[model samples]
Target: MQAPSMWRHTLTFFPQFLAALKERAESDSTVTVIGASDGRLVVPLVAAGYRVIAIERDPIALHGGEVQLPGDRTGHAMGLIDRLKREGFYDRVQVVEDDFLETGPATTRCDAVWTSCSWHYSANHHQPLSEFVNRMQRLVRPGGLFGAEFMMPITQRHHMLEHYTSPERLRQYFIGDWDVLLTLRTNEFSEQAHVGQLQDHTHRMGLLLAARASTPS
Candidate 1:
């Protein structure tokens, strides 16, 4: 199948997470994507035959609207809803237009849940990092997969907040019934600006993939 145009690309670890999901989850599994901006990851999962619960808060990200681009440019965003429809994967996704932390747990437990560089945003800093993570963890049922690639501290402000975390720091949450499968971190890298950020920026990122033990440990 042809790939849908996405507003943003996914994290480096996404393919690994997808492979892990395929290996660990049923083909018809339900996958929840937190901060599902314009179907970057959602489209791939649905195209691969997994049902998606896409939770995002920004209206412009959900419905088509004008947006700011790199190098101080302006452009139009086709948005997640339109992208899903264009890809013929609309029926396979459930769009939740709300803040993930505020929305709390999804009504149903998902077979897998993923988030990419979402929690470090200043808008999300009001909540504790533990709250954001705990809620995401609770959304996955036993034997489910949990994947997250997040921004590690780069700027001074980022270092001030626990949300800008490292794989080592994040691993503390995966103990007990959750088995951490992988942990990777990137050296500081430069990315051209887009959307929320307008100038070229450098960032360090971390990835964590864990699976919930099927039975109590």
Candidate 2:
């Protein structure tokens, strides 16, 4: 619910989180990034030497396109991609402007899949989560890893909490299929004020670094 303004601050600590996660990933790994809104997370992955396929639905956020920063939601996605390209990381990433749900998995295979703060956009949370998990399974080889950061109870509305999942529910959804690693709950405050006060909200996130189950021998 916190607007794009809040994202700036949240992203500041992202590098630390990524650094920790990076230790678990192999160098030059192939990672498919879904729902990569503005490439906030994808750029870091690229800089870390991971090959990425970034998927997004916003037209202005296509790979290699120019984007306005801070709050121009339209171009932010593309902007990040362009920045990465300028920095020589584009060689490690492929930018695609398409609905991830519509994009089939036959063209690009990956070693892992990473997503951040975008799943709440799904029309049906359960269905999308299932499809997303299945897609990750397809994109990564058997026993490969899947990682994501999701907003729990997604919303900034004072009276209304939107379609979000708690850490437990998220685990319930994937428990049998993947091994859970970490789940965290945290709070973020935004400059946007509601009724003359800055909007502060809590988000429960499931940071799952799980590996796909091995095929039966």
Candidate 3:
């Protein structure tokens, strides 16, 4: 699919995705976006009336940083969140410039944590994925939501490919701990693009959704 089509597909997923979060989370809930490359999801999320803390490892990923949005085709800006300000959603947004893996578990918990393809970085950096899940699991308050579109290949090896975790391994990491919401395996259909030099193949992936189990009250 082309970029427009891919974006449209993603947009189709967002309504139900946001609806799930809205159903389970409070209107004022704070959401932490892992690898918030741009305001793509952040904008709508803010428009939905939730506070968002956008985290990005690479500072230059935001369109506001001298890179215009996809459709604009004109690069002009200083930071990604500039558009957020222009749209009056900046007050509801926060940017955290830190590596998700290196930053350690957050002391300040959030009502939900979200990520796109970026969640796999920690698994790539750290051995296995237990540490990464533990870190994210700690950040969300119990009963809070944790959602990400995961890259789950049929086979993965250290420094071998971009596929970070297998579906079964991810289950081992989250099942006992979280109440699974959605877990469906699919391929990388966005423009039929290939990723990485060694892997070079778009393998199977999963749209992961789970809610941290609430403590016994």
Which candidate tops lDDT? 1
Model 1: ten consecutive residues of lowest lDDT: 2-11
- In the range 1-217, model 1's lDDT, one tens digit per residue, is 5333443542467988999999999999999999998788898999899999999998887897887777767777778998888888999999999988787446679999999888988899889999999999999999999999999998888888999999999988888999999988899888776667677788888999999999889
Count of backbone clashes, every candidate in sequence: 0, 3, 1
Worst lDDT run of 10 residues, candidate 3, spans: 2-11
Per-model TM values vs. the true structure: 0.94, 0.71, 0.75
lDDT of 3: 0.66
> Local distance difference test, per candidate?
0.87, 0.60, 0.66
For candidate 1, the TM-score is 0.94
What local lDDT does model 1 show for residue 81? 93
142: Cα error in model 1, Å: 0.5
Candidate 3 local lDDT, 1-217, one digit each (tens): 1121112224124555687899999898999888776566777888888999998776655543444334435443434466576678887888887777788658799999887776566444654467666777788888999877766654436336534655555666676658878776665543322112122244455666788878834
Candidate 2 lDDT tens digits, 94-160: 7877776677655656777777766665443545466665665577666667777666654555114
Q: Highest TM-score: which candidate?
A: 1
Clash pairs, candidate 3, are 64-79
> Can you rank all candidates by lDDT, best first?
1, 3, 2
Q: What is the lDDT of residue 91 in candidate 1?
A: 93
Winner on TM-score between 1 and 2 is: 1
Is 1 or 2 the stronger prediction by lDDT? 1
